[model samples]
Target: MEQAEAQAELRRRALDYHAQSPAGKLSVIPSKPCKSQDDLSLAYTPGVAAPVREIAADPEKAYDYTGKGNLVAVVSNGTAVLGLGNVGTLAGKPVMEGKALLFKHFADINAFDIEVQARDAEHLIDVVAAIAPGFGGINLEDIAAPMCFQVEEALQKMLDIPVFHDDQHGTAVIVAAALQNALELQGKVFKGVKVAIVGAGAAGLAIAKMLRALGVEAVYLSDVHGVLHAGRSDLTHWHQPFATAPAHWTLMDMLADADAVIGVSVRGAIPEAALSGLAAKPVIFALANPDPEIDPVAVKRLRPDAIMATGRSDMPNQVNNVLGFPFLFRGALDCRASQINQEMLLAAVDALARLAREPVPEEVQQAYGFSGTDGLSFGPEYFIPKPLDPRLRQWVAGAVSAAARKSGVSRL
Candidate 1:
């Protein structure tokens, strides 16, 4: 089929798939039996009052007496919905539901997707803070850039439970892991490589910070206004840390001679001609969804030695956030973590990077229809684990939980 026809068919099938269900992607089911009057008594009213009273007396008892320990609220204001951008709360419901689905399917965690129509950043923060008592963790989703930073920072400080903006931290964790393996494959060192990041939005900024934390020597961040330089009047406070050192350079100039180029920007933002200027065997992660900043095929044609990745599932080394969030939250919730700290994130990254180097299971290979023995091996094309790999839950969750304990964030 033609690309347009294929997309149309996918749209039709997606609608049918959602409509065929009980009208949506998710539903709440009782964890315990509620078939008899005896069961009902224990599940509610007089019998349930015992646990409620215990929780009221000692607030920490809620983790034991109620479902709060394993429940996450996937909250969103919908100011940025993937590539669609600022589609509002209601329109962003499907994506949030999909996130909830991943949480359940991947890590056996329960999630409630909450779409809040808040007036502003403060209102969103206030609303989330008010309803946060029932959840073990909060996964903030789809909020815009500067506001997203503000909302996450405010919530993390106010709430004792783990408050993570998945768009920022999730992407950061996966990208860091992939970059680790990709650098090794190309015989490059993190501390020596010059990295250029396009689109200094939530994901881009977070990735830059995480890379720097992982010991990358130099990171150049560029938004639509070109390279972020010191004293730029338009730069937000969050963008200030990433501003280049008193130099004037276009995005193309920054890309030139860099070891890697990561894009979280819009489609076609990075010019194809600029690929030639990159260091030999450059690592390119054109991570814009549905479409990338530079076409992978064109990149390969121009620089076949380049290591390439995208946000699409069909691509090799796809940096999907699904690889991080579910398991990260699982570990955090299991350990009764107070916050998702940097140590936890670094542990998650290391776990993922290590997992990719191991041999792929036959089951995972079969699921993705890999026929050859070499298909799953770690290399330039296979720098990250596939999203459906069941081992992610065990590896990432365990590492994160251990890190939480070591970092003094775990209540368990």
Candidate 2:
């Protein structure tokens, strides 16, 4: 679709969507038989007592006795939705509802959207922490950057169940998977890659830390005001640990000889001039949603040998968080993880990247209706599996669950 046409079409769809009103994506339905008096008695009064008694005797059995095990909650304050930014708690409903549907569809996990109107992070954290016991896991979604970091940290520190901010780790996982694949494809070593992370928000910071963990030699993280140097006195408390040395190498210097650049920043953060000095076979992920920091086409034009990826599904080599969130949550919830730590996140990345390395299959290709599935050449674009691919849930879940077990954080 052309730009003008796409905009008009989007507006039209938005109007139609609002017209249709509530009753949004899904509704809760009873799973047990409820046809007669015997059924009602069994499902509610007499039979329910048996499961309740068992669960009371052994608390862990609540997972088996109730839907608590496989069910997660997508909790948000609507303080930030996409780039729309601060749309209010109630306005964030549609996005949360959509996420719940994706969780159910991708992982056989039941997710409910909880939108609360809290005065601040402390208020929201207290409320969510109080309610956290009911959920097996919590997905903190589409909340703004620094605030998101604080909220997730507070909740994870306070709660027993896994609390994940998909914007941070989900995006980080997929980017890591794609970066691994891209580097492999180009015969590049991750160890020596001078990486530049543009956007010191949740996703960017997470990516930076993960890359550092994976051995990227050194990475210079930058936000709008420029490089996050050790001497940057204006750094927030949330961004402090990342304040490292060698402050002389600014973003300009860092990007001058960088091998990989991950842009989660605002539009057009990387000027064409900066692209000129990047190392050959540059693995650049301009992963800003809706619109990437630089158009992949533009990046290709400026740096012909560069490998490009984005957050948009319409484009080839899309580096989307959808590739990781459902499966990661599946594994974490199943393992009864106390929190989604670095180990579990890295494991998911490894599995996802490994899956990308295999030859694409016929059925998987058929699923996309794109003809790459029958042991076809699956490359960069296919690195991360689509959320609806039906296979990654178990694959990713197994990796995370195993990691959680290994990390000694698994209740299972």
Best by lDDT: 1
Candidate 2 has a TM-score of 0.93
| Pairs of colliding residues, candidate 1 | none
In model 2, the clashing pairs are 361-373, 361-374, 362-373, 362-374, 365-373
Candidate 2 per-residue C-alpha lDDT over 82-107 given as tens digits, one digit per residue, 9 for 90 to 100: 76779998889988998998888778
How far does residue 290 in candidate 1 sit from its true spot (Å)?
Answer: 0.2
Q: Give the Cα error of residue 5 in candidate 1, in Å.
A: 0.8
* lDDT for residue 192 in candidate 2, whole number 0-100: 79
Lowest lDDT sum, 10 consecutive residues, model 1, at: 244-253
lDDT of 1 by residue, 1-412 (tens): 5999999998999999989859989988988999999999999987999998899899999988889999999999999999999999999999999999999999999999999999999999999999999999999999999999999999999999999999999999999999888988998979999999998999999999999998997998998877988968899999998997446687778998999999999899889989889999899999998989999889989999899889999878889999999999999998999999999999999999999999999888988888676567888888899998999999999999999999999999
What is the alpha-carbon lDDT of model 2 when measured against the actual structure?
0.82
Best by TM-score: 1
